[model samples]
Target chain A: MTPTKTAPQNDLPEVYIDDILMTLKYFTDEHEVHLKIIDPQVCMNCESKPCVQFCPVGAYRTQDGGTVQIAFQSCVECGTCRVLCPNSNISWKLPRGGYGVAYKFG
Target chain B: MSTKEKLTFDVIVVGAGLAGSAAAAIAARNGLSVAMIERGQTPGSKNYFGGALYTHSLLEIYPDLWDRKPPLERPVTESGFWFLSKDGMVRATVQGGKMQNDPIDAYVALRAKFDAWWAEQAKKEGVFIIPKTVVVDFIREDEKVVGVITDRPDGEIYAPVVIICEGVNNLLTQKLGLAKHDLKAHASALAVKQLISMPAETINARFGLPSNEHGLAASVMGDVSMGLPGLGFLYTGVDSVSVGVGVTLEALTKAGIKPYELLQRYLNHPMIAPMIAGGRLMEYGAHIIPEGGWTTMPKLYTDGALVAGDAASMVNALHWEGTNMAIMAGKAAGETAVEAHQKRDFSAKSLSAYRARLDKTFVMTDLHQYRNLSHFLKSRPDFMNTYPAFLNDALGMFFSGFGKPKKQLYKDILRSLTDRRPLVKAAGDMIAFGRTIMGF
Candidate 1:
């Protein structure tokens, strides 16, 4: 429960993405991946991986091979990557019925 | 889990959020067979909002709203703006006993509870609510929408008319080529919020609420979003607080800033840190808001189909109003559907009544009035960054000028204004401000 990191020059606590995601509830559809990269090569040719920064839940990450990896399990279903992707490389759809994030106090 | 029987209704409404439920409820009340399809396990399970619900819109659907005891957190007795700089803030709060009375203006609402209660009410009105079902696309016939295709096996549900209230992502609207493309990043925002739980007594004391029944709704601008065209919101619930930030996706992408990181920074702000210091995190959520105003709104009606709520980009962003707009639009759409049924004509020409009805209400008028606000804020970064900081600096110098000559203090403030921006830039701001106000 310790502060993951501290804000520079301030006493404010910096919370990690995982710590935040733990507060949410999700019913994952293990068989079906709702979010997919239409082409990994399209993502690689792109210089700026804005998805890593723009995703509110940090669902998109950069792998060592320079490909963007999607940790869709933790996605809050905000639909940011579907629209914000510069190359429109994301093929996004809602999770199956009774699946995906369910907010207890949304 | 699969049904071979044909399912049909007079009207099918996608989504069970504020707009969908309201539309279905009204359509049923008008004696039409209605079905509301929800993607979540329940109506509200997949929803998230910034926590304030205005009463005027809901009252139009249910006159006895407060009497039924909806799932309201607290009546908003105090609300206003907190213009923040990095180190200081200028707060403007409007509170009174009048706001605490019945028929109150607004309340803090948790969508998970509120939307569920709304669906229950819609069911009471004889609307069949299909839960845990996602509508994949419209069931089109002869270039007209006749029903919806859900994710379930053989899940084709038919109806004479379809109303799409499926929120800001609005894939269904795009599939029909109503909107040209997915909303650009600049037209929408990525908002992340955290619900921090505390005792009711603790919340009362921290927020200076008169009692547990009273609450505060505050909107913040300036350094909270790091000078982006965004806003920060804090709403007091019965025993929890909702604190969040919504930054334009365009700005976030351009700046390469993580929205959650910005939210963390907001939580620790000097002006904001103390309120929820020791509370436990209850839930974290995010949502997309349509901030494109009137200009970006898609065509509201087509043959045998109509769009309402965030699906039509019906958000009055400057006023922090969306649910109210959605509810109003839903009511209109429902009435229009009932009218179409009465005439036995479900053509594009007949469904155009939805837009005509909306045009007569404040939903369209207010949106038209504030049409330029989103564009104005996005185009001018200084309005979000430079002006608030300058106000704080000027006020800081003036307040501490007790020992100095008053005239000299006035002179210093005037000097700082010019030093912040050239005369031409200031004049440009004045003209732009006029245009934004006039909404040309």
Candidate 2:
């Protein structure tokens, strides 16, 4: 019952980050920002700003004046930002029960 | 029930994922009251995996798992790696006839569906599942874990033994000083996946499979990660496919690429696009994999507490195995708990049996064998960048040598090897690869 080999020619598909996020279901906790920027000044001084690039959902975005904005609504809770932020500026905690991304087919 | 009895149990298993469920079920079946805590709305709502479940470990918990007809997607029959170089791929696969028979090797599964089903089975075994609750910290008494403090009101539940099956973000493990520190970017991998919806017939056709029941689990290395230390994977589900890439967090950070973008490049690759062409995106998710291996594993046991699964860094990264290790370790921890209760001693010395039990199984054996691997791979960037492309180029030359002399073709392949790397460096690569595999 193994998969057989086959070669086929097809056009490559285009992917949009926002379009991908649209397909997911999230029970947003309006009151709680489970993900927080512990020190905005620390983030501003941090040059690499790795969280802006490494976050899977792009929840952390840089504003015009150099501060980072967090759209915690879209967070998938991978916890990468908490660990990868060079300054350890992000305070991350689990969302309240039933209040985060609920994968339908994970 | 008395208030004391209502708030107490023999064991409290945290996280309700594969490991926690397995631990609760085994302990409850052994006549110990078990409470399993889950932070998700349901057991698997907050969980994600690489989409394959090995049957050997599950069989340890449910001997007749296949007969039970679990919510498994498809039995994986063909499994292999697709060595990719930007525009081309060289596939290597293994499909044994016996692997397709009874007691199948592995099955592709969606964690949401499969883990929910697994938790239900645990409940049936008399395990109390507390859903929609997060265990924030351990309730300790005299430096021994006596209970857990959750987010819910009056949520302190006392248990002599606590098993932490919490996944890769092991805050509790760190708090207990089990793990040396918070996970470093280099020590963990962030994987993002998209579940693509397609008809079963379309899936079968695209994959060149004989029937809907069989599936393929193919992992792509080399250019899939843009020559980075990561991999792309495609696992066939019943009516869909799971396509994803897992790259070390440090690699992703250093390269300045979003994980989803890396996944996008993999999806658009020439060798992969065709298989998933007409499918619609269903859901997207991300999870961190503990890649610290044996070197950074948290202390497995403490007085009245034990750690299992990703919390203990039990993943065998080389084989792409975590769930199986989690399940087996959980079962072993459950057995150890049973022994501890009988002895009426919950000291760390008594619970050291948990590690002894794992030592007898593949969980500890394989981890011990590959203890040096993560460090080896992390330092050797050329293994992913130079070797794969060189192999592909040499294969292309050999396959396209229709009118060329055989001697010239052999020389051409040798020239290609020296063109990318010095012969000495190539030999060094071989030795390093051998050491990685052979543990020399």
- DockQ values of all predictions: 0.54, 0.38
Candidate 2's residue-wise lDDT over B1-440, tens digit each? Answer: 23554498999999889899999999999999999999998999988988799899899999988687899988999899888887888888878777677778889999998899999999999999999898999888899999899988788999999999989889999988888898867778898998999999999888888898789999877877776777788999999899999988888887777777778878888888888898899999999998877877999999989999988888877788989999999999999889999999999999999999999998888888888777777877777767778878889999999998999999999998898889998898789878877766
What are the per-residue Cα lDDT tens digits for candidate 1 across B205-274?
9889879878999998888888889999999999999999998888888777777888998898887888
lDDT of 1 at B317: 81
Which prediction has the highest DockQ against the true structure?
A: 1
Worst 10 residues of 2 chain B by lDDT: B1-10
TM-score of chain A of each: 0.85, 0.83
lDDT by residue (A45-81, candidate 1, tens digit) is 8888888878889889888777889998998788899
